[model samples]
Target: MLKLFSLSSSLSILFLASAHAESQVQLSHVPSQSQVEDFNEPRGASKGVEARPILVIASELIKYFEGWYPSAYDDPAAYCTIGYGHLIALQACASIDLGEFARPLSKGAGAALLEKDTRTARIAVQRYVKVDLSDEQFSALASFTFNVGKEKFADSTLLELVNDGDFDAAANQFGRWIKAKGKVLPGLKDRRACEAALFRGNLQSGKNSTFDRSDCAGLGVASGAGPVIDIFVGE
Candidate 1:
């Protein structure tokens, strides 16, 4: 009886060891560390692309559209804005303790605010876009979302078309959002045209690439104005 019990115990131990070996083999086939990192990144963050170039293009586009506001001032729609279109009252900037709403921001403060806003915008772009995009596409969308708020972008036909793989239609949708307070702002028109061109791959990189405002010349004004909010303002 003792011998028989020992044999049964040895068989059970062997079976457990075999199961452990099989699990290790299965785990070996699991996602790699890089894959896991890519999977875990927040929405709007790019994977398998160099982030610096995308960031540079996005920053340049945002700078061009938003301009630099070193001090908090009332935007056209009357929101307290600072830096590169960052609203002073945004929840994201709540902890930063920006003094008075009308106070002038230092260059360092402005740059820091712009960086944080850009990060937020980029994350929004990544989160809302359900399709795989090239770096340029992602950057252009990020720039667009930075100009238009995330809520608007999320509800926009542009995002719907892009997710549906209708690139052409999505590219054309940028022109439709040019109105601000029932007026077609020339700045927004030009910005949207540039963004559309970027989305279509018409604008190349390097020294030769230029954002031509002429493309928006004939596009008629849109009467339905969007909410009068500056970039990076939280809901």
Candidate 2:
């Protein structure tokens, strides 16, 4: 359900006057898979603080928990056990946030953020506002990364499908995940469903690339705004 509107048409007069001064720009700073994994888990804590170790907790759950964990709320142990789960969530959040190189962390906005380099993550999120997507789609993409590492999303058919604008096929492919390494797992199947919903623009569904609010204030709406501003302002 991609909506077609012409904000540009409405603003054609403004655009024409601005078009001459505007210059096109391309983004080439692709994020690497290894870069995201480096932040996949929490690292050392203060020497004497004795803080909860989030990475250890999440890693343990992933290793020991058998088939279909079904989120923290569904697990009776998760409800009965407060402290350990909280610690795990903290670690998961931290690792996830760091995975995007410390960009904004929304509950279900993980997938899109993961493939971005740190410098571009913030800009991407802001630019995401202009894209048409459903809330579910938006949140699903975010949460997908929250579960599966961002690396998977980057190297996934999901990204290709999204960039290609094949929403329905992408949705169909979401349920295809059934294996962990070589073994088919039910948990991964469910997770893929969630991620697919995100990919198909089901969650947070809306139009994309509609808004071009400058990354900075007082800047004209144009490509290369950042670089242009930097050249003039010397950031």
Candidate 3:
């Protein structure tokens, strides 16, 4: 493992070298926390059919919030995590041996693993969502699933509202997940707000995108689109 002292200096060089490491180009898959400006979507009601999922701007959003961690560490849930919030092991830190991650994880590997981890969310959104969604909306949901576990999302009222074709109510549910382990986290709050904005078809860019909100109210009054972030597969 690279020493912590040299990590920052060595990181960029390492990433440049490892840029060639990810040969098999791939793209891919959360929960929680909330911001963004509200906007009105031009589309009407959602079509009651499954659509293959694709991502737009979710990766950059995720990376911006999740930051980068090139080493294994325990998350708030005690899971052995690595890369960009990838759960290498779901068990508690004391229960699992992290000897395998003794070496410093590379940014390239982390990016690949991020794509790999996001696959689960993409599959979940594809399988469970019963309504047709725009790319921005789907990306928002995908981002949500990536943060929260699949089971939680599957059983969530948000999913229920989406299936019921109640988008406004569904949008409101994004704020319900801002708490981690019962405490309201600022990071989570900002993420949900941004996601809600995207879900409402408002693509927010630059420094002013994040807002400190707790719910999805008033997110239905605006217009715009977001940028594409990563490789995604859809039908």
Model 1 whole-model lDDT (C-alpha atoms) = 0.60
Residue-level lDDT of model 1, residues 1-235, one tens digit each, is 9999999999999999999886544322211112222234585454453322354544566665666767665444344567666665423333456676447778667767666655555776777788998877887787777666666778787898899998877877777766554445566667777787777776554444433445433453233423333222312
TM-score of model number 1? 0.59
Which candidate tops lDDT?
1
- Alpha-carbon runs more than 4 Å astray in model 2: 1-131, 194-235
TM-score of each model, in listed order: 0.59, 0.34, 0.61
Computed on alpha carbons, the lDDT of every model, listed in order, comes to 0.60, 0.33, 0.59
Model 1 ranges off by over 4 Å: 1-53, 90-109, 204-235
In lDDT terms, how accurate is model 3? 0.59
Q: Which scores higher on lDDT, 1 or 3?
A: 1
Collision count for each candidate, in order: 3, 27, 24
* lDDT tens digits, residue span 1-235, model 3: 4687588768878887677443211111121211100012122222353434445366667766666668776655456667776666665556777786757799888877676556656667777899988888788888887776555678777788888998877776776665554344556666777788778776555454442233332333122222211111100
Tens-place lDDT digits, model 2, residues 184-235: 3444444444355434433231244221112111212223212211101111
Which candidate's TM-score is highest?
A: 3
